[model samples]
Target chain A: SAVISQKPSRDICQRGTSLTIQCQVDSQVTMMFWYRQQPGQSLTLIATANQGSEATYESGFVIDKFPISRPNLTFSTLTVSNMSPEDSSIYLCSVEGQGAEQYFGPGTRLTVT
Target chain B: GESVGLHLPTLSVQEGDNSIINCAYSNSASDYFIWYKQESGKGPQFIIDIRSNMDKRQGQRVTVLLNKTVKHLSLQIAATQPGDSAVYFCAEIVLTGGGNKLTFGTGTQLKVEL
Candidate 1:
């Protein structure tokens, strides 16, 4: 397991604004991912943060909406651009642990008004 | 359009009693499965995991059972406690270009009453 932390644990943003969430890990990991948990819904993968390269996004998610930046191995940022009420969700960052298991951060609770 | 699902949305268990949470997956190609517990305002915590080749695996007071033929997975908790009250989710791992991605099931809320 890895120790993961996210900045601005909770935030409220106005629609059309953007907010950047930061995730810091204790150790260097090879794989890091971002996920979204909507109200009363299951988690959906947003993108994979690649070190020093463009992130790999999942279907229905685009880089323009949720841009990811992984400058180094232990830190990454996810920016939600042009937020809306529908974008209000809990954003989580996780890293691959031993085998196929993943350790998740506490998550950033975002509410777009 | 396969998905992971849970048998029940909510479960109530008395303290010291055994609790069982069930999940079902539609994708047979999924080889790895994991169980996570999410507390109020907290992220999902890893509880236990099992591979497709195995039928059952055990952890501290927790057990995971997998039936490949039926595409069913179960988590059994012995002597449920108040701290065990949370939303439980089961996820399946699929290989992706980025890495292994997890597709989660509808969560089951577990309430433990003293």
Candidate 2:
């Protein structure tokens, strides 16, 4: 199992502001991903953070809105740009562990007001 | 265009009894499936995973069963404990050019009553 951690476990920000959440893993991983969990909803994949390359985002998501940076194998950052009330959700960082099982960090809960 | 969905939104089970949560997927190309448990205010935690080549896989007290013919999946927890109460989600891994992406299903809330 891999140990993962996220910065600013939670934060409340004003609308139109941006917040960057950081995710760190204890060891190097080949695949790291950012996910969002809306209120009472299942997890949605936002983007796949690639080391030294631009992140691969899913449909309906764009880099302008959610920018991701994977500087190394053990660290990544996801920024929620121009936040809105709808963007108020838990942001999670996960690393694909052994046998395709993904291990997640304690998500960063963001509340936009 | 593809989706993973659960048959039930909520399940209530008595402690020490067996519990089963069901899921259905629309993508037949998906070859890997995983079960996750998310407690309130926390991220989804991996419980167990099963590959398409196998019909069943087991962890400590958890078992995952897959029926490819029906595109259905199930997670069975034996002797359900209070800690097992949480929202459970089943996700299918779709292999893409970028990497393996997980499409999660509508979660099922499991309530363990003593």
Candidate 3:
């Protein structure tokens, strides 16, 4: 199990503003992922943040909207750029460990007004 | 190109009773599957997983059953407690195209009443 933490656990932002969320893991992990969970919806994979490499965004999501940076093995950041009311959701960071099971951070809840 | 889905949107059960949540996947090539529990205002927690080669796997008070023929998966919880109330999700990992990429399904909210 990994102890994962996210900054700005909950926040309210104005539309057109951007918010960058930070994710930290207790130890080095091979793969880090970002996910979005809309209210009353399932989790959607936003991208995979690989250390020292460009993150891979999933379909319907792009770097321009959800840019990601993986500075090191234990830390990463996801920036919700040009935010809109539809972008309001819970963002989570996760890491896959030894047994191939993924552990998730506490998640950042963002509300755009 | 791939999607995982659940059969029910909500499930209600009494305390001390058993609860089962079902999921279905579209990709037969997926070899790995995982179940997750997400409480309100918290990240999802891994519950248990089963491989395509196995039909069933058990964890502490929980069991996962896989039916590859029908591309169906189910999670069973025994002696449900009030604290066990949460949204449950099932995910499938296609080891071929991407490296350990997980596709999550629509969640099932389980309500355990005392």
Assess each model's interface with DockQ, reporting 2 decimals per model: 0.49, 0.45, 0.46
iRMSD, per candidate, in listed order: 5.2, 5.3, 5.3
**Descending-DockQ candidate ranking:** 1, 3, 2
Q: What lDDT tens digits, residue by residue, belong to model 2 across residues A2-111? A: 99999999999999999999999999988899999877778899999889899999898999999999999999999999999999888999998766678899999888
Ranking by TM-score: 1, 3, 2
Docking class of 3: acceptable
Superposed on all Cα atoms, the candidates' RMSDs to the truth, in angstroms, are 4.0, 4.0, 4.0
- What is the clash count of model 1? 0
TM-score of each prediction: 0.95, 0.94, 0.95
Q: Candidate 2 has which clashing residue pairs, if any?
A: none
lDDT for A12 (candidate 2): 97
Per-residue error (Å), model 2, residue A63: 0.9
Worst 10 residues of 3 chain B by lDDT: B1-10
lDDT of 3 by residue, B1-114 (tens): 111123338799999999999999889998899999988778999999888999999999999999999999999999999999888999998774334788998889898888
lDDT of 3 by residue, A53-92 (tens): 9999999999999999999999999999999999988899
Candidate 3 off by > 4 Å: B1-8, B96-98
